[model samples]
Target chain A: MSPSKSPLIAVVDYGLGNLRSVSKALELTGAEVIVSSKPKDLLSASGVVFPGVGAFYRGMENLRERKLNSALFKIIKEGKPFLGICLGLQLLFTFSWEHGDTKGLDIIEGRVKRFEGNVKVPHMGWNQVKQTQDSSPKTKDLFQGIPDNSYFYFVHSYFVVPKDKSLIAATTEYGGEFTSCVCKENIFGVQFHPEKSGPLGLQILKNFIDIINDSQT
Target chain B: MFSKRIIPCLDVKDGRVVKGINFVNLRDAGSPTEQAKVYSNENADELVFLDITASSDHRKTMLEVVKATAEQVFIPFTVGGGIRNIEDIRTLLHAGADKVSINTAAVENPKLVKDASWEFGSQCIVVAIDAKRKKSVTSNQNPEWEVYTYGGRKPTGIDVVEWAREVESLGAGEILLTSMDRDGTKEGYDLELTRSVSEAVNIPVIASGGVGKLEHLYDGLTLGKADAVLAASIFHYGEYSIKQTKQYLKDKGIPIRL
Candidate 1:
């Protein structure tokens, strides 16, 4: 948050993850990124990000083994804003139904379920998200100046269904109305991979950084 | 929905853009970089640079040409020709090329497609297939087509339809299918070839070769179901600027960047 010191953000790297791209994107925003599997780095970081791809159970197992679970909970409890992407977002739910039952961070009440129907399993490519419940300051805060119905790059089949409908920030339609992003107090999660979303996606990251900058000030 | 794309393909040989007749009668089009700049200024939606000589020459020179072209052009550019491994893809990507196209190398070793996609995201990888229709020797041949490599010189004996699906599953984000029979003919794209490949794959299909007039471009998009139309002869010989072609398409209610 200090103008002179680069904002140090810890990207949780738990052996099986997409650490490099998440780190690169943060670096593009002029933030000092420290990719760490260590709990100590997570405790000391000003901002924390959980960027992941691939299966749900494996991602949770890696996070739990590395003890990132407790550290992340503590960081969020301290009201430090946290962002989760894809499996990162799915990890925040109470449980995921992928490859059997897998417990999540439980920061928000939700469950991840596989997309059902005749369509492709992995809902790939760009899809537009329709924003809902604009009352929350984080709504305007996280989305920033991006236009309504702006498309974000997506590559996932399972989506988050928040227990508290109030927590839902945006919804996108593939088979039906599914949660694309959710915000609860200091925590934020997105089901889409923003780094690969091109310019519009970069703006979302910029917005998150701006929020961090403002909160610290 | 996104606008349909009009792409100008520059087949580069020895760092210069060149055009050939059915993969022969090679003539210099211009400097690859210079030609790219012209396309960029002319409002071309995208540019494709095929290192036509990748198999015949050292790989480093192709990278150099890509580096130079990337420096001059701002719009998205896809580079192909002689990309053999992940390192080759990485080199071109680091040089500022938006996407890397793998053809012969992918057909030679199918693993290259998956490896490249894993190393760099699938969006950055494209598979270029040069296809030609086989004359019916017997009625039992099913009137099918075969895939050709080394600029349509060597037949792979692989069915064009089946190979397209395999590459798409291997995480190729798009397919650049060129019809050798239609190359330099200026009649139109091989609609049968384009439609078959487009239907076979879920990813975006780019129709290449035999684009003569604006209507041919339209046929590629409307009839052929190609997401993009890639032409060289029409654009290279100054028969039409990309802007004019785009305007023609747009006037016909086909979405295109003006």
Candidate 2:
């Protein structure tokens, strides 16, 4: 079958994976998705998706093992539209307190911490996300047309606590208002699984695809 | 605030969705993928597909059903029944399942819960408990429920609350609590059994079984204090839609996503 003219979205597969659902969801947005471990895919694609589940340390280790770590940094540095989900979002931070102190990609200035107090550990199920205001056009477009405080599916024990509060794109209440989304220029990371978030989640992915299509010009 | 989830469970047997009344008298609903899409489009928070096929050879059929559903239906779904090992969990996850629920397997070897949780994170491990209320001499006596396995056909003799606590310690992210007596009777969820287990575990407890109407769903979340409610007959037979249930819950002052 001949390839469509849609923008190619490369989903980084570093072994700490949920590659199938992520890629399938991306494909649903009419984008050509390539689930690959090769750095070439990341560099060549119009946009990149760094989706993951499981441990932050294990995710980083797998990225390093496959030599996709530097490739990811290069893609972000090159101003390519990038989106991270769940652990993928956590992997962008400076370090995490999960298990022991584990260093992350340091792409964003933040520390990942576990939920404390009366809150549930996983923070699972549907929760409302309130979008934050930022001057970045990309940040605004990320949640464009999507209503503020819309419910998104979340399932994570640790959340990113970014040092630069301005980078936070959205916040959700659990224990007490943790960062649900982070945006810096073209880099976007969401704590919830947009792929599993139903229609609104599909809308979020469609927005990301729109961002990618808009960036091509 | 986190919204209470309303899940519609589909029991798939030989690739079709079926709801067995008390684990027998099976009634065919429709295709697994079709029913899943309907529930998803209706905005059900999550979906659970329990493979009730007795033969192990039909596992491939279930996998195909899962793959098809994952491709079309874009909601978080959990697959359960006969998931006995790590490979079963891994295969289901690879097929695009968000979580896997283990029942008989987890009871036989509690290590599977620890190992699966360690390998794939506790967030994806859901321990399903099918419990039956034990006979009590007097109304003043403290009530007790015993865990049952093999589609509620065999009793494990293990106390429900204690087992729930044990699984939570074993790293289960959530518990799918089903009351055997209330499962098909439609007398509403076994509130006592649900509350006991919910109070025992810190992780989320999804109250399942015996949901006949919108009020039952409300009762499960309010009185039972379960994080989520799962029902098959009400949804499978189109007695009530997820939207109606959520609206009813919302009207009744329960936090639900509509």
Candidate 3:
């Protein structure tokens, strides 16, 4: 892939989350990765990846405080291929009970709730994610070239519950069934970290690139 | 079920594997990145790189090694040793480490643990505790384990169980519990110490040190109730491959990646 023709994807930096590893992984997939906090830089990118690593309330607070929420909404509104990771995925929901009821982006009608049952909190390590029964951008692109039930690295205590189960692109089992990947039009959110999820993880990033390429045409 | 993790740890001094370079330790252990790649290929669940260097000059070298290893090895990797503050954690994470293990610093200034947990998120902060079993459990004596710092040279007099609970509440996501007495002895893990700490906390505990054979790994998980087992010498010296270790765990009906 020519450098000039390669997609310049912006990894939105809200002063939180692991941006370096994501940037490095994106670069390896032949995309020009940029760690940018500026709204203009993120908006101008061919693809935007919003990632988070902290509490739910803090994540929304940072996004709003840095004016990234508006910038992110604008990027999504423009039909850009947007990817939200972990807490970034939760931020798109309506509210989270993480630290006493925090509001989210509401881009998708969902509520983030803590995992409760006999299982351990902060569900770490690799677990299988099965693609939903449909042929959309998710199975057709985000997870393209990857098999269903493929294991991916996950580390989160709370999982998002989309109001419409149809919005769930993939599902994973921890204490019980939880939405692992949610897709709504051009926006994609995954609870698992593709960067640290090993080879299949890297493949997910590459698959996103394909979606970005498809969008340009 | 979340599979039991088998982690291979490498000790580095000035960017070179300790014993391999110094000729005093183990010798011929190989470079960290090379060993790390080999472990990744062997299907080790995760890798931990400890920069045991005291010189500031080698800190940058460690970062380069971490960067190269992170670039080549595609798995969860953690870096520890000499991490004093959140800035150190940030620098290492920026170099591509998935997590940072805070030991002496977390003990000296407990606030550093809270600060790091918030800055990098609790999942990224691993509080590594080196605990030594207190002699005798008489009514007048303290609890079973005491937290030690400065390479186990200084005893903080803090109860290991209490410390384990404190770190978790302080926002630590995981604990790397090492037995100072069992370290390098290869007898097996301090099962009592591991059980006490694991039972006392809600987060995952990685039982480290004192592993001479494969059964020890099983005992660490089943007997000690640990989430993971970190072995250095046993796997580093080529006595056992990660494949064989996972097979042993599997045969014992333990949930493993293999």
At residue A40, give the lDDT of candidate 2.
93
Listed per candidate, the RMSD to the true structure in angstroms reads 6.4, 3.4, 3.4
Q: Which candidate comes out best when scored by lDDT? A: 2
Chain A alone, TM-score per model: 0.94, 0.95, 0.96
lDDT of 2 by residue, B85-132 (tens): 999999999888889999999999999999999888899999999998
User: lDDT (0-100) at residue B231 of candidate 1?
Assistant: 91
In order of the candidates, what TM-score does chain B achieve? 0.90, 0.94, 0.94
- Error of model 1, residue A198, in angstroms: 4.5
In order, what DockQ does each candidate have?
0.09, 0.75, 0.54
Better of 1 and 3 by lDDT: 3
Per-residue alpha-carbon lDDT of model 2 for A1-217, expressed as tens digits?
A: 2234588999988876467777888888778999999999889999999898888888878888898888988999999999999999999999999879999999999899999988767899999999886537777778877888999999999999999998998999997999999998899999999998888888788889888888876
Q: Tens-digit lDDT track for model 1 on B98-179?
A: 6789989999999999987765656677899988888863776555789999768899999999999999889787889989
Candidate 2 collision pairs: none
Consecutive 10-residue window with the lowest summed lDDT within model 2 chain B: B20-29
Docking class of 3: medium
lDDT of 3 by residue, B1-258 (tens): 468899988899899887442222423356788777678877888889888899987799999998888777778899999998878999888788889999999988999989888777888899999999888678676458899999899999999999999999998989999999999999999998898898888888999989999999999999999989999988877788899999989998998876
Which ten contiguous residues of candidate 3 chain B have the minimum total lDDT?
A: B19-28
What is the Cα-based lDDT of residue B225 in candidate 3? 96
Arrange candidates by DockQ, descending.
2, 3, 1
Q: Which pairs, if any, clash in model 1?
A: none
